[model samples]
Target: MTETLSIGERVAWYRRRRGVPQEVLAGLVGRTADWLSKVENGRIELDRLSVIKSLADALDVQLGDLLAEPSLLDWTPDTLGGTVPKLREALMDYQQMSPLLASDSTSRPPDLEILRTEVGSTWSAYQDARYARATRLTPGILAVAQHAVRAYEGEQQREAQALLAMAYQGAAMVLTKIGEADLAWMAADRGLAAAQESGNLVVTGSLFRSVAHCLLANGRPTAARDLVVASVGYLENDLADASPTYLSIYGTLFLVGAMAAARIEDRAMVNQFLAEAEQTAQRLGHDANHMWTAFGPTNVAIHRISTAMELGDVQIAVDQGPRVDTSTLPLERRVRHTLELARAYSAQNRTDEALALVLDAEELAPEQVRHHFISRHLVTVWVRQRHGKPSHLLVGVAQRLRVIG
Candidate 1:
């Protein structure tokens, strides 16, 4: 329903739904009530995606919900240029390989232990923001895992199934970034099935999170929230005596739930989920990436900043972002947190700072930043809004990224 509206129409709709008076909303975000009124009435065009992003955050919706076009497919990597990369090709192969799917041998397969280590290495690449590298490993892992699942019995079979689930989950993550929601959903669907067979709570929760992530990218926040909410039951029985591994999984599911709530502007629900996640994080005491979940006190704080951004409190995002140290976290998390802060700065019309942060992201991870929609949006805004000569760096990035002529 909300997806059909124009950006301003969506803003007015969300703002009213949230029951924030124009004066109140404006004042909360450091803008004049008249400015907001004009924005809502179409007296002014909200040309900057960054500003619109801030407005949506203020309205407590996902940045896409207020977008002129909310479909992620509009700016998918394939749409950015003509061809999908090798990473996407690997994912395609995961679903396309024929012989691998048909092989049903019940004999001892390849080394399960060696396959498990390789799976861990792929996951490490994902954490480092080496998405292309990570995705490139997925197809091979998926093939190996399928063979292991058919041949190995007992504990080795269970381990193989777990690895297979993670491989699918990994495919889903990278596929989502490339804006292949349908493909990503397919991978997630396979992952959930494997998790059920493995009967591993942590793997089940993680796979559920992967599905939620795909749904979120596909603009089904309500469905995503419901999906994640149902998966929380996996952690309940063991949480009381949970190890750090269980705690991380426990907290991450809730955090992802909070994000889903944020997308729909359900402040109370978001807070409720975050509060539960906070308790779990507190028990864990410090930040650590267990099962690749990255759940703990610092991680929870990072999500708080993200929630604040989703809630449209740019000031809170700005304030909280710097306090969380990125050095200890994975590069993917750092890139995500930093990009949000860059959006917050752009919301305030701080173009130079936003540009600088955009550059920082590119420097931190070339793969993630290359052909990124946010970078393209930022470049377009800088071209439209900058006086005289823009920064050589900005022009260079925009030109190199083909964001501007």
Candidate 2:
């Protein structure tokens, strides 16, 4: 007779099949490799519900699959008792739509009703955190979402698949912002896989564009460019012109292409791609907000300023930089925009204006100002040039920002 596997054994088996080395899997799930090894060997018990769920997610297995003891099925109902019903419900809900919540506009009311009923208490906890809770919940949410996608694969539920993909994408964005680049990439990969399997060309393109953006942020612009170029065929071939989602995805890809081109010092290609993005943006109807154009007009303008700065077009950067409404931009993006403006002013030999802009940005978000790549780089360059007396205003701003650090 075959030996029955415990939950730990099952988790280990699935993780191995997924080709995730213990060390890498442990790091992704925020556990020590040794501890994970002990858990797998059945020498150590995992009691924390969150940790168990995180493990299940990393292994791409259902939570029940990890917890199930096949030989224990003969035990009385009291053995598992009150938790069994909840576990069954969670499994069933995970099967239906654990990752993605149905959208009000896109989903049928009945389908939404089913999901709402099935998700139950879990949904409440998931949405409870109000402002900037990405740091706390992103990893757990991502794990849950990934597990949901794994469960629903090949089940012919297009809506469920799309929702799961969106969840993965959302989790990835949160992770990326929180400085978990590898985890962010993994989340993006899961989203891309689901998007491809669901045959949603718009989603597929958007996922790739997101992955490229992550890569670009992680300092691999070449890899980012390759991903974008690879995605173009899918975007052009499978996407319909009437689909605003598709157009928005294409426009984002072009925006990234322009940035990548600028990174590589290819001014001609950068201009060409930006022009293409502009044309695509023009074609987008009023409904483009539903697509991946979350950045929209302000974001595009910010990129224009950055690109102009990179291409030595100081006049263009200055003109467009001020046109962006700083109030509407996110704290991080606004800081970056201000830093770019500072760089533009510095390039124009207006050290006083550049320092003043930097000071303003520091006041908005001191932590953001301190860690900002462009601002730090610009200041370094300006200081090295010994551009006049070191401005007292800049010194005061730096001292205040240090308090937050």
How do the predictions measure up, each by TM-score?
A: 0.78, 0.59
Pick out the ten consecutive residues of candidate 2 with the lowest summed lDDT.
Answer: 69-78
Off by over 4 Å in 1: 1-108, 371-373
Taking the tens digit of each residue's C-alpha lDDT, what string does model 1 give over 245-292?
888888888888888888677889889998999999889998999888
Clashing pairs in 1: 57-311, 57-312, 58-312
Please write out the lDDT profile of model 2 over residues 1-405, one tens digit for every residue. Answer: 112344466678888789989999999888899988987875564433345656876776654455431111112232333222232243234333433542323333234334423332232222221113323333334344444444443543565566556656665654444344555576678778877877777777778887986775454666777777778866677555446666778878988887877766678878887877777777773323444353456666778888887666789988878888856544656677888898888777798898889888777655445544445444544443454765666555544433111
**Which pairs clash (backbone N, Cα, C closer than 3 Å) in model 2?**
none
Error of 1 at 46 (Å): 6.8
